[model samples]
Target: MNIKFVCFSLIVMLFHGSIIAQELITPEKAVSLALDNNYGIKLAKTDVEIAKNNADILNSGYLPTLTGNAGANYNLDDTEVGFADGTNRVLNGAESSRYNASVDLNYTIFDGLGRSYNYKQFKETKQLTELEARETIENTIVQLFTIYYKVAELVENKDAVSQTLNISKERLLRSQYQFEYGQSNKLASLNAEVDINNDSISLMNTTQELNNAKRDLNFVLGNTIPEDFNISTEVDFNNLYDKNELLNKVKDNNISVLQINKSIDINTLGVKSESSAYLPTVGLTGSYGWNKSNNNAASFAAYSVNTGLSAGLSFSWDLFDGGSTITNVRNAKINLESQNILKEQLLVSVVRDFNNAWDDYQNKLSVYRLQEHNIKTAQNNFDRTQEQFKLGQVNSIEFRQAQLNLLSAELSRNQAKYLAKLAEFQLLQLSGEILNVEY
Candidate 1:
C-alpha cells in the first residue's frame, strides 16, 4: 500500500509539474494581460459601449415613428328592420364583412432643445465611462508592478537565507572536524549544528513567503497561479519627480478628477434638459387608410368602399406640473455643484497621496542605501571573523553573531527595495500614468 501511494504521489507531481512549467512574464506583459482580462475592466469597457450606444442621435427621440394597422371582421345573423313608412321587413341568414388597413406616422418637430442637451449629456457620460475604465486599469497596473517587485524582494530574501544556511552548514562541518581533532570543544560542535537547523527553518519560511508573493501576483494578472516562476530582479529607483511637477501632472491627468469634471458637465446638461420642459412641444401626425363593408339582406342588400388621407399638426405645452420641472432643474444645479465640490476634494486628495508616495519612496530608498552599506560592512566583518575562526583567533560565538548581522542586513535591504518600488508605483497611480509603465 505504501509503495502504491508513493507511486500515485509521484505521478500527481509529474502531472502538475508538466502543466505548470514556469510561466515567465515581465511586469509589462502582466499589466497588459490584466487589462485585457480583469473582471472590473471588462465591465467598465461594457459600460463605455453602452454609453456610446446611448449617445446615438437616433436614440435621442429625433426620428418619426411609423406603424401599420390592418384588420378584418365577418359575421352572420338574422335581422328585422322597421322603416319610417311603418312597414316591417325581415331577413334570414344576413351576412356582413368589413376590411380596413392604415398607415400612421408621428414626428416630434420640437422639444425645446431637450434632445440636443440629452445628446450632449450622453457624450459626456461616455467620456466618463472611459475615464472610469482608465482608473480601473491604472489600479491594476500599479498592483502588478508593486507585486512583481514584492516577489523580487521575497526571492532576494530567500536567496540570502539560503546563503546563510550554507554558511551555517560549513561552520557545522568545520566544528565537527575540529572536535574530532580535539581543536574545538564538543559544545561548539553541538551549537553549530543547532544554528544550521535554525537557518534551514528560516530558509523554508522565506521560500514560503516568495511563493505567496507569486500567487498574489498571479491573482492580479487574472491568471492561474503556477508552482514556480522567475521575475526580473532589476527595480528602477531613479524615477524621481518634484512634488510641484507631480501635482501639475495630477491636475491634468488624474482619472478620478477628470471623471468628476465630466460629471459636472453631464449634470449641467441635466438642468438644461429639465428646463426645456417648460417650453411647448410640437409634433406632426399623418395617416392614410382604406375601408370596405358588405351586407346581404333580401331587399336591403348593400356594399360600399371608402378611402381617405389625413394629416395634422399637434402641440403640447406643459404650462405646469405642480412645480416638478423647477424642482428638477434646481436639484440638477445642486448636484452639479456637488460634483464640483467633489472634484476639488479629489484634487486635494490626489496631491496629498502623490506627495506622500514620493516622500515614502525617498525614505525607503534611503533605508535601502543604509542597509546596502550595512550589508557590505557586515560581509567584510563576517569574512574577517571566518578567517579568524579558522586560525583559532575568534570563537564560534563571534562568528555566529557576524553571520546573523549579515543576514539581518540583507533581509532589511530587500524589504526596503520592494517598499520603495511600491511607493514608486503608487506615485504613478496617483498621476494616472501607471498603465504607461514599461518593464
Candidate 2:
C-alpha cells in the first residue's frame, strides 16, 4: 500500500514535469509579444510619436527665415527726352520695363519671452503624451497577467476534474466486485455508479470551461489556440512584502500621478505664453540685391541697372484686448486647480486599491495552503476506507463519502490555487510592481 502511494506521487511528479516542459512561453515573452502586436498599445505609442513631432515643430521659430522676390513693370516708349540743351540728348532708358529682385531675411531678436514660454509648454505637453502612453501600456500589462492567470486556473480545474473521475471509476469497480460476490448491498453499488456518472458530467463541464478560457486567452494574445499549451500551475503566493516600498515606488512610477502634476505646469506656461502676446516684440529684417530692366517695344531701347542694401528693426504689440487676456489667465488658474484636485483623488484611490489587493493576496495564499493539506489527508482516508471495504469491514456509504471528500478536496485545491495567483498579480499591479518589472 505504501509502495502504491509512492508510485502515485511519482506519477504526479512526472505529469507536472511534462506540463512544465510543454510550457513554451514566459511572462516576459508574453508581455513583449503583446506590446509589439497589441492594437491598442501600438496605436497609443503612435500618438505619442505624433505629439513628439508636434513639439519638434516649435524649434523652427529659433531659426532665421530666408526668401526671394522678383517683379517687372513696362511702359510704351523711351524717346530720348533730357534736360534743355542745344544738343540732342540721348538716354537708353525710358518707361519700357523695370525689374527688381531681392533676397531677404527675418529673425526674431526678442518676443517678450513668448518663444521661451511657448517652448516650455510644448516640452510639458510632450512629457504628458509620453506619460499617457505609459499609462496605456501599464493597463495592457495588467490585463495580460490577469488573463494568463485565469486560463491557467481553468486548466488546473480541468485536471482536478479528471483526477476526480478516475477515483470515482476505481471506487465503482471495487463496489461492483463486492456486490457480485454477494458481499455488498445493491444500494451501495448503485450509489457508487451514480457518483461515477456525476463525476463524468462534471468532467465534461470542466473541459468546456477550459476550452473557453483558452480561447479567451488566445484572443488577447493575438495568437491561434495551441490546443495543448502548458500553463504554469504554481506561483509563490505567500511572500510578505513591504507596503511602504510600494508607496514610495508609486510616486516615482505612477504615470497618472506624474501626468496630472505636469498638466498644471503646462497650464501655467500657457498663461504666461498668452500674456506675452500683449507685450511689445522686437525683430530684425534685412535685404540686399541687384535690379535690371527689359522692354520689348519699338523706340523703347532701355538700359537700367541698380543695386542696394538695407536693414532695420521691427516691433509689434497687441495694445489691448477687451479683457481676453484676463479671462485666459483666470481660466488657466482654474485648470491648474482642477488638476491638483485630480491628483489628490488619484492618490487616495491608489492607496485603497493597494491595501485591498494586499489583503486578498494574503487570504488566498492561506486558503491555498489549507486546500493542499486537505487533499493529502483526504486521499489517505479514501484509500484506507477502500481497503476496509474490501475486507468487508466497512459499509458502502462510508467509502462513497470518502470519495466525495477527495473530490471536494481536489476541486477546492484548484480554486484556491487560482485565486492566489490572481491575488498576487493584482497586488503586483496595485503596487506598481507590474510596471517596474522588465519585460
Candidate 3:
C-alpha cells in the first residue's frame, strides 16, 4: 500500500498540463521544505557551521603549543682555541660550523588577567552567532508563510473565474439553441455571446495574475516554475479557533523571541568576560636546547662541546597599557543593558503583532461567512429568475443579472476564504507553531 501511494504521488507530481492540479500542502510541510531547500535557509545553516568552527578554534587555546628550532652556522675565521691540561692551542685560520636544535613549549604562565576574559568573550561571540542564525531563520519563515498564502489565494481566484466562464458558455449555448427554434430574439443570442467573451477575457487576466504569484512564490522557495504543481482547496476557514491560547504560546515558542533571549544570555556573559580583564591570570612554560661546535685545521687545533640546557617560568603584567580595560568594561556593561532593553521591546512587539493579526483574521472570517450566506441567496434568486425567463415572464436582461449575481458571490467567497486562511497561517507563524504542526 505504501509503495502504491508512492507511485501514485509520483504520477500526480508529473501530471501537470491543461487540467487544474491540486496538491495538498500544510504550513508545516511548506516550512520544512523551504528550510531544507531555500537558499536563505541554507545560508543561515552555513552561518551556524561557521560559528561552531570559530568556537572550536577559541577552545583550542587551553592546549599547550610546541615549537621546534634548528640552525647551522659557519664562522669563516678560525675562531676557536682550547686548553686541555695547561697550555692554550691556537685554532684554525680555516672555517668551522656549529649546529643546534631544540624544542620550546609555551603554556601561558601568567598575565594581567587577559586570556581568561578574552576566552570568555570568544565563547560569548560564538553563542551570539548561533542566536543570529536562529533569528535569520525566524525572519525567513515569515517571508515564506506570506508567499505561500499568496500563491494559494491566486490559485483559488483562478478556479473561481474558470467556474464563471463555464456558466457564461452554458448561457451562450442555450441562447443559440433558442434562436434556431425562433423562441428568442437574435439580440438575446448576441448578448449571450458578449457575456461569454467578457468572461473569457477576465479568466485570461486572472490566469496571468496566478502565474505571477506562482513565480514570486518559487523565487523565495529557491525553486523554478514547478511543472504540474497546484495547491489543494481543502483548507477550512470556518474553524473559529481562539487566538488567546496561540498568543500564550508565542511567549516561549516564537523563534524570534527565543533568539532575542539567547542574545541577552550572550550579553550577560559579555559583561562577565570584560570584568575579568581586571584580574590576574597564571600558567606555566619551558624550553630546552643543545649546541656544539667543531674546529678543523688550517692553523687550528680546537673542538667545541655541548653548551648545556636551561628552563624557567614566565609572567606578564599590564601595569598600565592604555586604560583599555576600564573602557572595555564600561562598553560591555552598556551593551548588556542595551540587549536587555531590546528583549523588552521585542516582547511588546510580539503582543502587538498578534493583536493586529487577530483583528484582521476575525474581519476576514466575517466576510467569508457573509459571502457563504450570499451564495445561497444568489443561487435561489437565479433559480427563480431562470424559471421566469423560461415562462417568458422576464426578459434575458433580468435573467443575466441574476446569474451574474451568483457568479459574483462565488468569486467573492473564494477571495474571502483564502484571505481568512492567510490570516490564520500568519497568526500561527507568529506563535511559532508552524514547526509543531504534525499533519
Candidate 4:
C-alpha cells in the first residue's frame, strides 16, 4: 500500500528469485570491456600508431637515398667489317658481352627550411591523431554510461511493477473472500479481478522493456550474445559543479577544440613548407661506376674496361611553373586561415553546447528532487487510503486510484533520476572529464 513496504517486499522477492544468481555488472567493468572490445576504439588506436610512425625523420625528407645497379648482356651473330682502305672481312658467329655496375647517392643539402617545417607538420599530425583517439575513447565511454543507466532505469521500473502486481493479487484475494461472505458486492470483486489483470499486463510490459534495455547494453559493450546480469539501480552525480570552472575546462580540454587547434598548427606548417618552394634547392650527388666490354670480331681491341667515381653539386630554383608554386603557397595560406576560422567556430559551438548541457543538468536535477518529494506525498496518501478501504470507508475505485497514484509517482521518480544522471554525464563529457568518472 505504501512505497517503503512495496520496496521491501520487492527486494525480498528478488532475493529468492533468479536475480540473486545473475552476474552483477558494475559501471567500471562495462567501460573496461568496451575499451578492449569496441571496434571504433581499436581502429582509432591503430591510426594513432600509424601517425606516430609517420612522424619519423625518414619520412620527412631529411635522409639521403642510396641505390645500387648491376647489369650484363651477351650477343651472338654473323658480323662483317669494311676498312677505309677498301679491304673487307666477314666472319661467322661473332660473340660480344658487356657488364656494368654502379652505386649512387643523392642528398638534399638545403631547401629553404622546407624539410624542417614538414617534419614539424608530421609531429603535429601525430598529435592530432592522438587527440582524435582520445575523443573516440571519451565518446565510447559516454555511450557506455548512457546504456548502463538505461538498463538501471528499466530495472527499477520492473521492480516497481512487480510490487504493484503483488499488491493487486492481495487485493483480489481479499475481494474474493469478502464476496463469499456477502461483505462485498460482485461488482467490487470483478473490479479487483480486472485490476489484477491490468497489473499483470503492466508487469509483463515492464519486464519486456528491461530485457530490451539489457540487450542494448550488451551491444554497447561489444558482446555478441546478451549476458544475463543485474545492474545497481543507483544514479549518482556531482551536484556542486561550478559553471565557470566547467566552461574553462571546456576551452582547455574539449576534444573538438583541441583537434581544431592542432589542425591550425599543421596548416601553418603547410604554408611554410609550400613557401619554401620559392627558394633554390641545393643537393649533392655522387656515384661510383664500372663497365667492361668484350668483342671477338677484332676490328679494334678485344676488350675494353672503364671505371670512375663522379660527384657534383646541383642547384635549382623554380622561377616559374605556370604559377603553380605560387598557387600552392596561396592555397596553403588559405587553408591556414580557414583552420583559424574553424577553431573560432568550434570554440563558439563548444561553449554554447556546454552552456546548454549545464542548464539541462540543473533542470533535470531539480525535476528529480521534485519527483522525490511527490512520491513521499503519494506514499502517505496511499497509506491513509489503504486503511480507509479496509474499514469500507473508501470505495474500490478510490482505493485503486490511490494505488495507481503511488505507482505512477514511483515510475516518474525513477525516470527523472536516470534523466538527471544522463544530463550530468553530458555535462562532464562537455568538460572532457567523463573519462575521469570512478564507475
Candidate 5:
C-alpha cells in the first residue's frame, strides 16, 4: 500500500470551527506541529547553520591577515651620557619620549596543501551536520506516529469496554425486574448487579488508560493542543516493499552510516593535515613603520624621526620534533582505519535490524489478520447468545461470556495492528525514509 494512505488511515480526522468542540487532529498535523515546536530539532538546525558558517571560504586559511598598530611611551629619570672622547654629561630631570606606528601584512604562501585538506574537512563537517538534522527529524516523526497510534488503539478499546458495560447494566435492570415480580430468585439479581459493578469498574479503568494515552500524544506533539481528543479508528496493514531493496538503500541513506563515512573522510584528511608538519612552511611578511624619539637635557636637546618599509619571505622546516609528527600521522591513519571498520560494522547492524523489523512486521500482520477473523466470529456468537438470552434459551453467564469474547478479540486486534505499524515505521527509519514522511 502507499505510505501516505497508510499514515492517513491511522489518523483520519475532520476539522470544524468551534472552540467548545473537540479538536480534530491527524498524525500529519501532529508531526508538523512537533517539527515546528520541538526543541531538539531547533537545536540541530542551529548546529547545521554553525557548520555552514565555519565552512565558509573566508574562514579557510587561504585568506591574508592585516593589522595596524601604534604606540607611544614617556619616561623621566636621572640619566648620564659618556662619549668616546672622554666628555661626560649628567642631568637631574632627564626626559625622553618615543612614538611608533606600523601596518603589517602576513600571509601563508604554502603549507604542504594543509589548507586544502582543512577546507575539505570543514565542508564534509557541514554535510554531516545537515545529516544530523535529518536524523533528528526522523526520530521526532517516528515518536509522534507511535504515540498517535497508541492513543487511537486505546480509544477503540475504551469504546468496546463501554459497550460491554452498557450490556451489563441492561442485564442488571432485567434481573431486578424479574426478582421484584417474583419471577426469578434473589441470587440471580445479585449476580447480575455484581456483573454490572464489575463492568463499570473495567470501563472506568479503560477510560483512564485512554486519557493517559491522549496525554502522551499531546506531549509528543510538543503540548500544543488539548489532550481530550478523538483519533482515527482505521488500521491499515499493507506491505509492499522488499527487504533486500530496503537493505540496499540502508548503506547509502542511513544517517549513522553516512556519519561514519564522513568521519572516515575527516580522519583521512587529518592524516594529510598532520603530514603537513614534515614540509617547510612558506610565508610572506611586510610592514611599513614610523618612529620618533626626543631627549631633554639642561644644556641641549636632541630629536630624530625615521620611516622605513620592510618585506621578507620566511620559511620553517621542522626537520625533527622528537618523532611527534610521525606518531601523529600514524595515529591519524589508525583512526581512519577504525572509522572504516565502524562503517562496515554499522552496515551489518543496519541490515540485521532491517531483517528483524521486517520479520516482526510480518508476524504482527499475521496475528492482526487472525484477530480480525476472530472478531467476525465473536460478533456472530454474541448476537446469537444475546437473542437466546431474550428468549430464555441462554443463561446470563453464557451471554456475558460471548460479550467478553467479542471485546477481547477487538482489543487484541487493535494492539496487533499498532504493533505492525510500529515495526513498519522502524523499517522506514532504518532505511532513512522516515524523514520523507508527508504531512
Candidate 6:
C-alpha cells in the first residue's frame, strides 16, 4: 500500500492545514539560541567574570595600600590664667585654629609567602569558575538536543499513526461499499468503523505528545513566549566512539573532574595560606604629614607649624592566639584532605557514569539495527497481505493484523533511532565533548 508515501502525504496535509505558519528550527539554531539566551549559562558566565575580577594580585594583598587623612578645627573661648609668681591675666574672645593632613603607605614585606599562595589560589578559583561555566553550557546543550530529538521522534510517530488512520478509513469505506453491494456483512463494516475509531484515538494521543515535547524544547531554548515550531525529523546515527579513548578523555577532560581537581589545588593553597599565619609578618610603613596651629590670644607663641616625613619597618608575630592558629591550620589541612577524598570519589563516579552511558549507547544502536530489519520484514508482510485481501484470499482480520504489525515496526524503529541518538549525546556529555562539538 506504499505506507511511506501515505504517511508523508498525511503529514504534509496535517502541517499545511494545522501548523503551516510554524517556524522550522534546526539543531544548530537551537544550540545557538540556547547559548545566547539560556539563563543558567548566562549566570555561570557571570560567575566566571566575577572570579576573573577577583584573580587580581591586588585582591591577593600583594600590593601596597595608600591612605590619606586631613582635618581642621576652630575654637573660641574666654581664658583666665594665674602665674606661679602670683600674676593674674584675663583674656576675652580667645581664638585658636589647627589644620592637619597626612598620607600613609603600608606594604607587606613578607608573610611566609602567603601573598604568592593567595595569588595562585585566586587564579585557580578563576579557572574553576570557568570550568563550571563550561559544565553549564554542556548541560544546556545536552538538554536542548535531547528535547529536540524527542520532538522529532514524536513527529515521526504521529505520522506513523496518521498513516494507520488513513488505512483504517480506507478499510471502512471499502467495507461499507461491499456491504451495500451484498458482498460484505454488516459486522465487517461495524468492525472497520471501530478500528477507525481506535486509529483516530492513537493519532490524537501522538499529536498531544508531540505538542508537549515541542513545548519542552521551547522552554529549554529559553523562549520568553512559547512559539510553535517544526524540527528537522532527520536522525543522525553516524557517531563512532571507542570506549577506551572515551574513558581516557573523561579522566582528563570531564568538567566535573576538572573542577574537583581545581578545588583540590585551591585547598592546597588554603593550607599554605593558613600555615603562613604562624610566621612573623614584616611590613614597610611610610607617612608624610603637615600640621599648623594658630592662636589669636597667646602669651608665649602666636603661631606654630610642623611638617615631617616618617618611614619605618614594622614586624609582628602571632606568638599565641589561644590555639586559634593551630586550629585553623589543622582545619585547612583537613579541608585539603577532604578535597582529595572528593576527587577520588568523583573520579570513580565519572567512570561509572561514562561506562553506563557507553553501554546504553551500544545497546540502543543494536536495537535500532534490529528494528530496521524488522520494519523491512513487516512492510513485505503487509504488502503481501494487502494484495491477497484485494483478491479476497485473506480475511479482513488478517489484513488488519498485518497493518498493525507494520505500524508497530515503524514506531519501534522510530523510537530506537531517537533513543540511540540520545544515548550518544549522553556519552558526549559525560566526556565533556558536547562543549567541543561544532553546533
Q: List the global CA lDDT of all models.
A: 0.84, 0.77, 0.74, 0.89, 0.84, 0.88
- Pairs that collide, model 3: 16-228, 91-300, 92-300, 109-283
Per-candidate RMSD, Å: 5.3, 6.4, 6.0, 5.1, 7.2, 4.9
TM-score versus the correct structure, for each prediction? 0.89, 0.79, 0.81, 0.91, 0.90, 0.90
Task: State the TM-score for model 3.
Answer: 0.81
Tens digits of lDDT, candidate 5, 1-439: 6999877765554233243367778766777788887777888889999999999998998999999999999988787878679998887778889999999999999998889889999999999898889888888888887888888888888888888888888888888888898977887778888888888888888888878878887876778887566666666555488777888778778889988988888898899998988888899999999999886774254887889999999999889999999999999999999998888888889888888888887888788889889899999999999999988798888888898899899899889888888888888899887767543
Prediction 4 TM-score vs. true:
0.91
Which pairs, if any, clash in model 4? none
* Model 4 agreement with the true structure over 1-439: per-residue lDDT tens digits: 5999999999899887876678778877788888988888889999999998999877989999999999999988788888889998898898999999999999999998999999999999999999999999988888887888888877888888888888888888989899999998899889988998999898898888878888888887778333788777766665588899989999998988889989999998999999888888999999999999997774598999999999999999878889988999999999988898888888899999999999898999999999999999999999999999999999989999999999999999988998998898888888988887677
Q: Pick the candidate with the highest TM-score.
A: 4
lDDT of 3 by residue, 66-177 (tens): 8999998887674455556776656556677788988888786555444555566566667767667666666777677567766777777677778777877877788888
Looking at model 1, the pairs that clash are none
Q: Which runs in model 2 stand beyond 4 Å of their true positions? A: 1-23, 57-60, 68-104, 179-194, 224-227, 287-293, 296-310, 392-398, 437-439
- Count of clashing residue pairs in every prediction: 0, 0, 4, 0, 0, 0
Q: List the residue pairs that clash in candidate 6.
A: none
Estimate the lDDT of model 5: 0.84
User: What TM-score does candidate 5 reach?
Assistant: 0.90
Q: Point out the higher-scoring one by lDDT: 1 or 6.
A: 6
Worst 10 residues of 4 by lDDT: 219-228
Q: Please tell me which model should have the higher lDDT, number 4 or number 5.
A: 4
Model 6 residue 112 CA deviation in Å = 2.5
lDDT of 1 by residue, 130-213 (tens): 888788777767767777888888878888889998998888888888889998789998999899889988888888888888
Model 3 regions lying over 4 Å from their true place: 1-29, 57-60, 75-93, 109-128, 237-244, 295-310
Better of 3 and 5 by TM-score: 5
